[model samples]
Target: MSWKTFPKVELHLHHEGAAPPAFIRGLAKEKSVNISGVFAEDGSYVFTDFVHFLSVYEAATQVLKTPEDYHRLTLAVLEQSAANGVVYSETFLSPDFCGNRDLSAWREFLHAIREAADQAERDMGITLRGIVTCVRHFGPDKAKQTARCAAETAGDWITGFGMGGDEGQGRQGDFAYAFDMAREAGLRLTTHAGEWGGPQSVHDALDDLRVERIGHGVRAIEDPALIERLVAENIVLEVCPGSNVALGLYPDVASHPIARLRDAGVKVTVSTDDPPFFHSTMTQEYEQLEQAFGWDEEDFAALNRSAIDAAFCTEDTRARIIKRLESQ
Candidate 1:
């Protein structure tokens, strides 16, 4: 069955990473910026590996320099998500990219993005929320600045704080202070773990950072004890199977641990971490999972229910999204 119109709740999209290659190319040409190295002859992003992907990702983001640029980006991203039936989505926004962790500048960028999001909601009936994120590779000091930006803007719109970027950079504990600051400001927390780092990384994120959810916590399958703990603690995993396979973490979707993790009673939700970068969409992810694991509409509906439960949005927003999901 085609999953194109199936309502989905996404919780782990990266704002900059979601930029479509064609959009980036257009922006680059308009700004006279050269980012031809990041794209292939077919106009899709090209990267040798995860680390190289980061470089290419950053190179592509170089053309997005102003609040207006982010405004356009937010609209373009939401249009893609809406097309694929993503009813509600929470996107990771890095102050490092927005305004170099400057509070005032970040606020300006946030305003533009929020304005676009509001417009999208009214026009397309797709809700968008922001999660302020710190780039792990940028180090702990910069993370504190990003966290401060998050704290200053802690509200209904900016609901959560997370850490993204290379999980191999530093231990999750190294950024405890930043996480603590965000927590103090009443922000929900989540961080990248178990994707590049081992199962131990998931433990560190839980024991140290105290996050309620984990981004790409697929490696937990390698440790039975960790899987049990995740279930016991009810920590949601934002599993991006396509992103994992695209980065060569797994050979294909059939080899991905999402099905195993779900069968083991772990709360797993689907997301397109960087859809364009991974050449994936919400509908495409559903199709792949269905083909690989024989997941039917009921399975996907359950996944969507789990996703809305784990989403960082307010109760009112959650209820509205749930209503839409049920109506569909």
Candidate 2:
């Protein structure tokens, strides 16, 4: 009955966004940065809307000033994720945050993060892979630099490229050059879409960005044709039900589109988009799905299988995790 003990895989987590508020607060205090307004007395992030949440997310990252800081952060995040039974995860890592879009500077942070992840794999039962991500609102030009950073190290640790942030950005096509660069480097692609924009945005991401998976593509349910297209294409959706409720994208867990998307023959996987910010853990995500939709262990296992299939990791790694999942 304790979902916390169930093996799980996360595919759409954000690196800095997963930072514990206490972790950020500690870093802020060490540097004398006054960001107390970002958190409530309960030590939870506060934001009235999505745009404000984006600003708050960036403000919190200012505390992570060095690669060592990211090393510490990676350990902390992995510990929390492991405790919640996340056996494997692929997190979104923005080069913009690592080094402000500088390839040389980003390398240092990537090294630190990868080192920490390796250590965590040894210490905890969690395995992590990084996806070099571009912040969409930062514009297409900046995305090109992020793609460069991803392409430079697209082999093992950094296996994927993605875009996150404001979904209302110009258009997915505007970032074609960056996606092309990552594609040429053989990086698997994904993009944040349909969470904020309508189904048309999801369509643009498919036609233009040509992503294999989508982050928060729940809104695609709005267009039946789009839904059918998604089913036909067999694109996976990284659905974060808890995040949807927390961000007011849905009124409650029961109203989330995850079940509908699944029943419609769409491949879907669950993740905590920003765990701490939404006051959710992987255990809580599983519990809510069970409570809201009467899901059972088999349901969760199937979801994990879908995540493993859609994961931007090596076949060897995926097979290893699938073996562990079967043991559960």
Candidate 3:
């Protein structure tokens, strides 16, 4: 069977990062934002390295100046994801982008996004959930505010809290207060680790933040004890093979440690962390994994189940997703 024909689940996507280049270009035209260099002649985002990638990301975000922009982005992104055979996804949303750390504006953005999400579920049969994430590189004070917004807006759609940014910025412990606040509000937690940093970063994220999942945790392969602990604790790794390869984390797809980590008894799920930035989609991720590791239908199905199990959605939603996976 073609990998594109396999139904899948994505648990490590980012809201703004998923915006298509055409969409951002149209928005730029509307707002008269000077972001031409950010895209290529064929209308795709262009960046050389991780730091420049962040700049391009923020440049694309400049056009998303209102709640309605985000609402439209949510619908557009989901439509594309559904076309790529993704049946369930959880995307990271930043309060800093939604409202610049204002709770009221954040609520408005959340409402718009949730409304679009409900419509997407009805029209495309795709389940969408939000994980309120703090930009770790922005500073701990901002993260606390982001956590406060997430804590205040705890509901069916906003189900989780996370940290995403330059992992090398501040120590993981510096953000413990924010995670604690979100935990108090009963939000499931995760953090980006082991992507740009080494195994010690993963250790700090687990020991300090106490996350239930690790985003791009392929680096944990460096520490046998850490891999054993992840298996023992049953923590899920939202592995994004395409992102790792694009960012030089791995020299090539053949060298990726995803299959090895799974072989070591660690639970793993696949996702496209930033689809357009990495020139990847859900279908592409599955296809590359198949080509590199000879992943078959059963492997894809089990990966879907792992995503559903690690998802931060409500139990009822999870049950429905599991039922869909079984039917697939």
Best of the candidates, lDDT:
1
State the lDDT of candidate 3 residue by residue for 127-238, as single tens digits.
9999999998999999999999999999888899999998879899999999999999999999999888888988899999999999988989999999999999999999
- Given candidate 2, what's the lDDT at residue 173? 92
lDDT of 1 by residue, 1-328 (tens): 7899899999999999999888999999999998878999999999999999999999999999999999999999999999999999999999999999999999999999999999999999899999999999999999999999999999999999999998878799999999999999999999999999989999999999999999999999999999999999999999999999999999999999999999999999999999999999999999999999999989999999999999999999999999999998
How do these models rank on TM-score, best leading? 1, 2, 3
Please estimate how well model 2 matches the true structure, expressed as its whole-model Cα lDDT: 0.94
lDDT (CA) per prediction: 0.96, 0.94, 0.92
Model 2, 26-77: lDDT tens digits are 9999989888668987889998888989999999998999999999999999
The collision pairs in model 1 are none
TM-score of each: 0.99, 0.99, 0.99
| lDDT value for model 1 | 0.96
Count of steric clashes across candidates, in order: 0, 0, 0
RMSD (Cα, Å) of model 2: 0.7
lDDT of 1 at 58: 91
